[model samples]
Target: MARSSTEAEYRGMAHAREIANNPVQHDRTKHVEVDRHVIKEKLDVKLVDIPLVKIQEQLADVLTQAVSASRFQDSLDKLGSGDIYAPT
Candidate 1:
């Protein structure tokens, strides 16, 4: 569902779908969800700051997809940390 679907199809999908959907959807989304749009808006207005994520602390790869043994091990090493990918 996450890897194969087009951005438009994803927006039309359940849960991952946008709440205030338009007739035409964006080809690529700057925000992953409706609530995330707030952060994007804040970023555009310089109201929030973004923090960097260390390579070793990034665990989203596990949920994202299968990877090399080394990378999977890295993910397992830090499964409870905060999400690393910066929004907006």
Candidate 2:
């Protein structure tokens, strides 16, 4: 049976933290299935980190929707990004 998204997120959080800290064990996490190995490999190679951001502070919306000018600049500042073609 498939787990719900919330359940899967919580479950993955627990197992990922543990799996990330220990050496890879192909047979160690059989209970959680095999997908975790992909995350573990990424962690092993320093490809990413999971950081929690508040919903209001999420910047991805800037890319997906229209935002006010100030809000757009705020998001850009938060990301340390800027427009290169603006008048100097």
Compared with the true structure, all predictions reach lDDT values of: 0.62, 0.73
- TM-score of each model, paired residue for residue: 0.41, 0.38
What is candidate 2's lDDT per residue for 1-88, written digit by digit as tens? 2245456668868877878567665357666656677788887898978778886687965775667888889999999897899888
> Pairs clashing in candidate 1?
none
lDDT per residue (tens digit) for residues 1-88 in model 1: 4673354356556533553354345434535555588889999999998989874566775666557887786676566444366474
**Model 2 misplaced stretches (Cα beyond 4 Å):** 1-52, 86-88
Q: Which predicted model would earn the best lDDT?
A: 2
Candidate 2 TM-score, true structure as reference: 0.38
For model 1, the superposed segments whose C-alpha errors exceed 4 Å read: 2-37, 50-58, 80-88
